[model samples]
Target: MKRAVIGTLLATLAMVAHASTPRDLESSAVVDGTLVLAKNGTVQTVQIKDEARYGKPIADMVRKAALQWLFYPVLREGQPVLAKIDMHVRVVLQKAPDGNYTARIKGATFGDMDAKSTDALSNAESNKRIAPRYPIDAARAGVQGTVYLALRIDRSGHVTDAVAEQVNLANIGPDSALRQFRDEMAKTTLAAARRWTYQVPTTGRLASQDHWTARVPVTYTLNDRGEANPDSVWRTYVPGPYTKAPWSDKSDMDSVDAVVNDDVRTEGAGPALLVSFHQG
Candidate 1:
């Protein structure tokens, strides 16, 4: 369920935290756009919406990679239908020993821009969110990462249960030490999530359901200064092992990771992508 943004460690490592610093200047990046699909699931057109922000080099790599992608055909009442989808692609540039770099598409997620049109899980119009406090141990050690949380909400828009689905660390270290740090970050995130609430869908297919499932990621950065913009660029990170929520049917990993910005992704609300999105 985890996407390894960086293929291989580009630089030598040490047991210390700063030893994990990236030698190459090219950091991980994210690009998003709309993809038009034919009835048979072939990509008819690809648009690079964030080229100016991500730069042409990164945008071109994502565009070429996306053209070769094939998705599961969308169906309406067992009949094939043409569809348009919003896609977010994560790119990582790895420098080889020969001093050359290669762009790899680690993962991509496909869904509809408007969630209300589909019966699948979608976010309500209103919600109250509380940012999690940076753990003292992690902050002191200069640890930074993003924690994706899976939440179960009742019809009343109250969080009934919350779990940390995955934690990706911007810093790297020994496997044992990284796991312990991730746990500390997850603990704090879950505590804050319990106090949050959201508006339930009143018009969609899931509105009448007894409960809804939603996923949102909380990021911790040392230089955020309380005005964090996650979509500007993605920092390299080592993805931790994914923990599935007890109420989840499968590990819906791709949908949540595609959210480069601060937004809640409701389950089952967008067009279903049947094929694997890994391009690396």
Candidate 2:
């Protein structure tokens, strides 16, 4: 069966305090898990892989929210059937005017890990993921975002063309200024991506094709405090518009907007969510 994702509006949850703090106004964390959905489309069970790493309060809140989520049924042969999806949830931390901090569900996305889509190229090796240099202006301004990239690779595994499909900014500002930054970042990412190479599938259905188009994301972030960016913690950003690549298949446009930081230097990374569940 051709893989497909159920479409729905983004969900937001009410803010619940995790701890009292006035230091930072906004931050986010990504929670990875597996969700088992019943034929009716309700989440039957969820197992968070690193639940303890996010603390009990946040863990409990995530679990509660997951149970309440409703999804369109996954169909096999035109019949609703049980399905399991790998999900990634971005939990944002916000500080209220009163100096109290609360955690809320920012966004979530579902994907099938076992999907064998021939349209997307696979990563060759871990070391092959060469991260692009961060734009100087963006770094000076503390601007961060993920650049969704569309790359055209020849059968010989060399990138022949590259384009920035979208650029989501972490910090907010006027639309004009945001566009400027997006252009700057996209330019830098495209420069680097043009030099990238991928592994062509030898046994897949499209191996004989002259070229393959692949989609990836490149993230630009700063770690000024001498600490590596935590896998669990994510930067909250405003997503940019999706631009279809000229050589891309129209079906590729159906991808969700939720992007994860893991996509920055990795290949075939799952979608990272960017929706808010609740408002307080």
Candidate 3:
């Protein structure tokens, strides 16, 4: 996806947090005060209730809470002045689907480590890490082959290995060229893969372990006249590194990728072949 589109999508996703209610609110209070817009556009406030404690004296949080209460000081001919404001402390509760209970704080959104980390996994970050080694566009134009690599990501968010899972280039006029191209692309992609970082949420003070399996499709196309088509595509399939092996050697090798390729023959006029150099 384009960068702008991806950014817009992420923005939309972030807006979802507004609709989310805080799990606990009884412990939190809303500090009500009149927001006096100073001549310099800064807000000045007078605290009406001094009994409430916000754990930490964070000015930003206090200002945000005050703004939500709609307590702005009255202005005279665009002149700003200080005014009194009402603040209240209320206890809020949220009932979960499992009959569990949680505290809900008004105007406060609970921070979810998982959601935060997931949002950080932007396409730009992925591209920056993956582009150099794979040189995706160039590899596709040079050789008409598909290389499948299985990537193993360690707990440290590093690509430990990217082993060749499959290579499909049966009908190419020169198999050696296609194979070499596949090997080089595989090496490049794997080399870049090591630099890619996956998102891992924090579990309390410690970070939770995380791993991801992603498939990158690289295609080389040839027109009816045997010229590079630029649209022919091949894909890389990385099975779940953290989950159970989807297909064991003792089990049937037929997978969703295999089934789909079986149904659609590429320009090579046959189903794609997956030759495993080393079994996982």
Off by over 4 Å in 1: 1-15, 20-27, 72-82, 115-129, 203-208, 224-231, 253-256, 278-280
Which tens-of-lDDT digit does each residue in 14-35 have in candidate 2?
0111223324334666787888
Q: Summarize candidate 3's per-residue lDDT along 128-208 as a digit string, tens digits.
A: 535434334323333334444444445555555455454443222223333444565556655765566644323322234
Off by over 4 Å in 3: 1-126, 132-142, 201-214, 220-253, 256-280
Best by TM-score: 1
Clashes of each: 4, 10, 11
Against the reference, the lDDT scores of all candidates come to 0.71, 0.63, 0.35
Error of 1 at 10 (Å): 25
Q: Which stretches of candidate 2 lie above 4 Å from their native place?
A: 1-29, 35-45, 52-85, 89-120, 125-129, 204-210, 225-232, 250-280
lDDT of 1 by residue, 1-280 (tens): 1223221122212235465455533356657799888998888888999588878888877777777778778776778789888887777778788978788776666667664554544444343436688876676566778898989988777899998988888777666667777998899999988877777666645677888888888888875443333434657777777788899785566545666545676776655555565642
Cα TM-score of candidate 3: 0.32
- At residue 81, give the lDDT of candidate 3: 46
